[model samples]
Target chain A: MKNNQGMSIIVKTVTRVSVWLMVLYAWYIILHGHLTPGGGFGGGVIFAIAMLNVLLAYGSEFTEKWLKIRLLHDIEAASILLFLIVGILGISVLGGFLTNFILKGKLYELISAGTIPIFNILIGIKVAMSLFLAVLILAKTNIENGGEV
Target chain B: MMPTEIWLIFIISICIVGSIVALELKDILSSIIAVGVVGLGIAVSFLILQAPDLAVVQFVFEIFAVIILVRAFLKKDYHKEEPSTINKVLVGVTLITLGAIFYLSLSVFKLLPPFGQPLFETAQYYVQNGATDTGAANLVSAIILDYRAYDTLGEVTVLFAAILGTLTILRIKKSKNSQEVTNEK
Candidate 1:
């Protein structure tokens, strides 16, 4: 059972190659959210899918080794707090909560959207961490119960 | 390409069929797959309606939901409980009630302004000014992150709370045997 934790070798190989591309794509969506249809939540889910791919291909051991649950929890908490701080900054400096305070550069260009990109990045991190933690907990509990939940 | 109106009707039919298949199927895995099809169909419809943001969200969420549900199913024996008479009656009554409500909602939706027409001034302003004001090309992103950021924050909090609730409900204590085994180790 230990040896048979994941799928076949072909799947493992494909996952190994696809993981990098998938992660890159997710980041692209999150960072370019101001211009594109995909936003932080969608990008974050894509990241979760990448994590899921690793877990599915090589088992939870590889996932735990690569990305620690402690790190994910920290990211989750810190991202949310940072998001709140960004909102508070708006209230203090911009006269409203979550106000667009940054300078609006030319449209369609990256880094032009005031706080939208920041929000996207923060949401991406928070959502990715939360989803990763959820999947990890599910997998761990399933294993603990002798694969019987 | 076929006219969008015709395509929409076809898609709606597919959604209806997929849902019925999902409901009737007893095999847990098959039912899950059918539900995924329904989700995908709905996502595609969102795309057709020019809501790329909604489509992306619907598509991504559907995939994750299917994957997680499959994982949960794998952990348990797929022994579907036989429906008792009371359960059957409850389902029947609920379905009928929902069917009536759904029909009425459809009629109400038809009464609304046609597509591409804004029913509110606020929406018109957002469409006209969101890009220049928020500096985001994507109006949805501008609205979510800048215009209604407070609302988005509340939504984010709700999501976190929901996840926390799931964790709390599903939590279990370590058995005595497991504790002893750990101690021995």
Candidate 2:
């Protein structure tokens, strides 16, 4: 029952050192989206790219152990629903659909942009999960063919 | 920063060369790499035009797009057939037409406002009043997530539809696969 999979040592070492750093940078990009150039979509894709890198270096087995594909699908669906709920709550609380209803914080403050940051987090999670699931399914396809893939 | 014209020239030249390299390279991987170079060149053009937001978006999009394309390529045969003469003729015609169109468009740029300067009233409003109106420092974020929040939601909905479509296709494949397994059993 020795099932060690994935690429050679060099790629694994590189991924080990770089992937977490990229994930952290992606979080920074998502959090500071209102104050910076990249927002949820871009940041989320970057985060997903890091996970894809892991899948590339370590194989689907490692990825499955880390994050089951079914869970990824659920996370993506739930995040989309959460996004809609956030919008509906805006209309309920402020009487305007998708209104920037959160109280304005001090300029340049972390909590200043109100709903934008929250939306950023939601969108980031949604996009990351969606991309990861897509990549995972595609990579794992042909697996049922006696695991020839 | 270099002069706008110089930046434009560098970007355009890189784009042309990259596109040609992508078209002419015999190796599929090299062609994809060349296409990536073209993508970077276009993103640089966006940055030169003072749209960092667009540049960042386009650059990240290009990366993922290339990844997906590469995956698709790996799933198939990499045939190296020479492009037909008709294709060469079409490329020549297209390039000439595009060159003529670009030359014509160069004159039109002078008639338009300077880069990053909003010409329309609404755009001007965003530039001048966005900070106070939306209470967000990044005007682009304020516009996309606040002022035009509904539009962004619609865009995200479209993305959801696309993802769902892909998932449905995959699920069908999985179902067919399971049926085959059961038949074997």
True contacts kept of 2: 0.50
Q: Which has the greatest lDDT?
A: 1
**What's the TM-score of chain B for every model shown?**
0.80, 0.74
lDDT of 2 by residue, A16-38 (tens): 99999999999998998888888
Which pairs clash in model 1? Answer: none
Per-candidate alpha-carbon RMSD to the true structure = 3.3, 4.2
Measured against the true two-chain complex, the DockQ scores of the candidates, in the order shown, are 0.55, 0.44
Question: Which portion of correct inter-chain contacts appears in model 1?
Answer: 0.63
